[model samples]
Target: MQKFPAVLSVALLLAGCAMSSTQFDATREALRGSPPLRQQAIADCTANQARRSLQARQDAARVMNVSVRAMPRTICTRLVAGWSSGRLSYDDYRSAMVGSMTPNTVRIIQGR
Candidate 1:
């Protein structure tokens, strides 16, 4: 029916107008397509969220060239715990930290 086509277009329009969570997350401003780091989960990574409340309590300090306080709470805690436990390698922590802090730009996704 003619009404069905109109209804379909309305549905598509509504869906298109919807904004993704990244549009509003402050931490994710640096990351494109990547939601806030708070949304980035480390699979199989285990840390007591408060367990690393769990603090060296140092700010502006660098370990593995990563800012101690710069990362999201869950990520920072896991990184610290994993590092201290000797389970996470220096390279691992460094890569994860730097990657998290790096601003994500559209250029990163351009096809060569």
Candidate 2:
């Protein structure tokens, strides 16, 4: 029974790590063609950032056992705009979106 729990934990962790790149690839594939479609996706994604931010905050709060403040409106706007204007690839845009929601991820990306 004890070994089973340890095995399950390791399996779950590895599963999560494996899915990370897969999710990114899937997003990129979905946005592969059609600049107009990509633009529309960026527009829609930008509009939804606020909600995503709020959800991220709530999730973090739950995990850290602390109260979380409301997410600000300006999160990820520049990156989304870059994607909207064709200045960023889909992968970069998706990374920015993820960074906007996760402070740790942003910090890591910023090398801070």
Give model 1's TM-score versus the native structure: 0.22
- lDDT for each of the candidates? 0.27, 0.36
- Please identify model 2 stretches exceeding 4 Å from their true place: 1-20, 50-112
Top TM-score hit: 2
TM-score against native, each model: 0.22, 0.29
1-112, model 2: which lDDT tens digit per residue? 0111111112112123424556544544554555665555545543443344455645533433344442212223333333334444434333333333234333321223
RMSD of each: 19.8, 11.4
* Model 1 lDDT on a 0 to 1 scale: 0.27
| Per-residue C-alpha lDDT of model 1 across residues 11-58, encoded as one tens digit per residue | 112222423344323222332234343233222222222223323312
* Ten contiguous residues minimizing lDDT sum, candidate 2: 1-10
Worst 10 residues of 1 by lDDT: 103-112
